[model samples]
Target: MSLVNRRRRPPAINIVPLVDVLTVLLFFFLVTMQFKQVSVLNITVPKIETAGKNEIKEQILIAVSAEGEFFYNDRPVDKEQLEGLVQLAGDTTPDMPVLLIADEDAPLKHVTLVMDLCRSHRLNKLRLQSR
Candidate 1:
């Protein structure tokens, strides 16, 4: 028999060990994973992937357009209407965060007005939603 033609062991790989290790890692991650409750109010924001990321409790969102229009939770409201809404939210949850999302072309006075309104309600946990 030729030296190179003798019995040669076929190359093989054992995948059982790899599968076992992967399963163990999956279980470890699952055990350590934390699931959070997303609030219904979260759906109102547009393309806001990271807004109020660290805020666990439901927050109040105040949006200002470039035309100095005020929107509370996506509903167009006047200053007095916004005040009532803010007061209601603030009274219900004292520690709720207020997220301010303003257009780039929006006037500074509109932003200031919303900020002032939030402060009046004693909703001090404020966050400016920005990219």
Candidate 2:
């Protein structure tokens, strides 16, 4: 009987499929990611006894200074302009949440005025921010 010798092939791993899956995951995360813009206002929010976490995604930020000034998204806005902005937001997205961040020393009148504006515009999802 003649003995035959066979050559053994080295073990190999297929990486093409792994690379495709990684590429798909990267694209998925990049497409569905949400970016938040940081607020530049120096607001000293008041402390609260019980404050729940705010999980609303789309929100309009209104800042009230201690001196009774109003700011929308960090930009100064007068009473009428603030009302117009609230109205526009209500007309566009009625259910959109409004976040009021007032300074600890801010007057109650300013806060009430913003609340009134929101109520008049029918934007009922109002969240007051506190420390």
Candidate 3:
């Protein structure tokens, strides 16, 4: 065969693996990261026999202390105020998720009162927090 000059193409950098790794990292961070709601009250959340991971995003944090005091988003509120706040939130965002943080020693009636108010205001997206 006659000797001929052959042109060689430059090596291409593959980006598929890098894209895959970035996608996996993004998913890992998104799945593990959650919104942490800080409460001013020292209410002990009740414990459950199940997992502690929550899939629902809490927009309104309603805390009930062992003494049956209500707190709305870390701010102390009375029963009437709580109802008004819930009503306003429900009117603004009907599907807003509400997280109830009640002390383990809190009475069942107190917890149910908050639940009843939420339901009355059409804010049924409620989830109970646990220790």
Candidate 4:
């Protein structure tokens, strides 16, 4: 046999398939992802002695901070817009109770304003948030 050596082919690395698979997975996850907003109402509910036991659902939660900032379902609302906001939420869940969750240090007037909104909307099943 001749002493001359033949050139060997370089090893091949195929990344096309890997890249395609990764792209497909990315698209799948993007399309299947669910978008939902879960608003949290941080509050210290007032304690009560004569409160009754009841099942509450679809309640419109209102929150007030210590600074007297008003929030309905975690969204800030101007005093002028209070009525419309409460009415809209109550209308959506007509039978649901209106729950007011106010901070312990919140002004009594702020808490009272929320109660007033609920009362004006004719919401009977009002509940206060508590620790």
lDDT values, one for every candidate: 0.79, 0.90, 0.89, 0.76
> TM-score, each model?
0.58, 0.69, 0.69, 0.57
Best by the TM-score measure: 2
Candidate 3 root-mean-square deviation in Å: 7.6
Scored by lDDT, the top model is: 2
lDDT of 4 by residue, 1-131 (tens): 55467677899999999999999999999999996536565555577677665456566777888788788778887776777988776666556688777888899988887888777776767887664
Per-residue C-alpha lDDT of model 2 across residues 59-98, encoded as one tens digit per residue:
8999999998999978999988999999999998888889
TM-score of 4: 0.57
lDDT of 3 by residue, 1-131 (tens): 43466666899999999999999999999999995755569988877989477777547889999999999998999999999999999898988989889999999999999999998888888889886
Task: Pick the winner on lDDT between candidates 1 and 4.
Answer: 1
Ranking by lDDT: 2, 3, 1, 4
**Each model's Cα RMSD:** 8.5, 6.6, 7.6, 6.4
Instruction: List residue ranges in candidate 4 displaced over 4 A.
Output: 1-55, 90-94
For model 1, the local distance difference test gives: 0.79
Question: Which ten-residue region of model 3 has the weakest summed lDDT?
Answer: 1-10
Of the two candidates 1 and 3, the one with more favorable lDDT, higher being better, is 3
**Which candidate, 2 or 4, would have the higher lDDT against the true structure?**
2
The deviation in Å at residue 124 for candidate 2 is 0.5
Better of 1 and 4 by TM-score: 1
